[model samples]
Target: MPTDTVRYGMISTAKIGINAHIPAAVKSHNSEIVAICSRFDGPAKQAAEENGIGRWYGSYEELLADPDIDAVVNPLPNSMHHEWTIKAAEAGKHILCEKPIAVTMDEVREMTAAAEANGVLLVEAFTHRLNPHMRRARQLVGEGAVGDVRHFEAVLAFTSRDTSTDVRLKPELAGGGLWDAGCYSVSAARFILGGEPVRAAGFAADSGNYGVDTSFSGLLEFPGGAIAHMRSSVEQPGTNMGEVIGTKGKIRIPHLFEEDTPLVITNADGEERVETFAGEPRFVVQFNDFSECVLTGKAPEFPPEDGLANTAAVLALYASASSGQITAVERV
Candidate 1:
């Protein structure tokens, strides 16, 4: 690899890869999508040609073995995240992995250790942190626009009648509305609260097949007595939004995570404010941040540690739901 070029590789033709990440990588400055791999050759080759990428492979291992690839994006299913991330680390390739870093805390710990040992930068792509609007909301919360934050409210849901056994609904595939959508709510709550959640109380509905939750609602108690109530579901219609209400004033991210418009704020004086990210690409922002971290050896704002914390909160919620009691998140 030369100092003049940013060589990129992708591990899947997943929907996110095709729709969001690949386009962002191509549009990024001085970077090229060198190679991509998929279990299926048809889609992989099509995606490579359609997206103007250099080459396509029918397997992930071959892509990892390519020395020309400076960085690899892991857009595989949640269950496969740890295995391939470790492989990428071993191959000395910088990695940008999708959210919910791993299915378990132990797995996250192992992946983090491997990245550190292999000396490759590993980042979890949580696009909300890169959103300028969310950045402003964090600043407002820090500035005490909302007096000492007491309770937070977050909800994300959409209707999905598709019963084709997609990854989101299969426990084996690490699919669930919680991992699919709730990860965003948990990440937002953790981001705004600026600390790990200590306890969680939750309830989950079963689809009666694989035991994966179709919907989950939970309460996260952070340090200093701040509490966040969150919910996510695939059985609903359209998108639901979230809010961080403090004592003095409050910031309302009408929609968290996804490229939301018109983030609003209301103060005790009855004045209203809005922060807008005008015509911005959400995944592009995330790709830029990941590229900077890889190129400059900088720490990403949301790292694997943040992913671990969110996973802990999620596991605790599931446990609470099973036991019919509030469960505490053990520090990872």
Candidate 2:
């Protein structure tokens, strides 16, 4: 492991890694993708050839054995995140795992513990939080531009062509709208509120094929009387939107998750303002941040504990949806 650059071994050739993380790593000055692995050799070889990577492994363990690699990017399936992250930590490699780091808090705790014990950094890869527009929104709200945040609403949805074949529709794999897309809304709401919800209540409708929730709508109650409404679905037209309403004003984000766009702010006196942010590739920002954290031995801006908080909230929402009652989010 060289201190000058973070050599990365990619855990899978998933679409997110191929389309986002790999490109971002290439563009980053402090990191490089040295190896890539897949369950089979052909896809790994293809990804390595196409991306100009030097090594390809048919199994993840082979990639982990490379002493020259300093970090690993775990873009594996949701169910695999906890397992691979712990393995990477044990291998003495810092990790950048995908969002909703785990389906449950127990897994989150175990992953965090493993990383801490191994003296490695483990960061949840939530690209939206790294977006300049998102930072600006948080800044404005923090500055009281929203006049003491009272409520938040977020919605994210996209239609899947084949629910039967998609991993997102598999219940055993921790797949569903809430785990897949809704986690964004829950995370965003938590970020804006800057606190965990005390109680959660929700409803979900399962897809007939796999018994995975195709649609989920939930409410979160924060300690300060602030409320958050979140909705997500895999059976609807694509939509991404969020709003933070306060005593004196409100801020609206048109594309909350997928893109950088204008943020609209409206005051009680009928004054409206539009704020535009300089566009930068979000994945680039994410990769750079992870590299900086790993190299400097600094905790990630959004640490593993934050992922635990978000997962706790999501779990509470699921509990509420299941029991038809408000569920309290357990503090970890």
User: Judged by lDDT, which candidate is best?
Assistant: 2
Clashes of each: 3, 0
TM-score of every model versus the real structure: 0.95, 0.97
How close to the true structure is residue 226 of candidate 1, measured as C-alpha lDDT? 86
Compose the digit string of candidate 1's lDDT tens values, residues 87-131.
999999988889878889999999999999998888888887677
Best by TM-score: 2
lDDT of 2 by residue, 213-302 (tens): 999999999988989999999998999999999999999999985455889999989799998877668888888888988888877898
**Residue 78 alpha-carbon offset, candidate 2, angstroms:** 0.9
TM-score of 2: 0.97
Q: What lDDT does model 2 reach?
A: 0.89
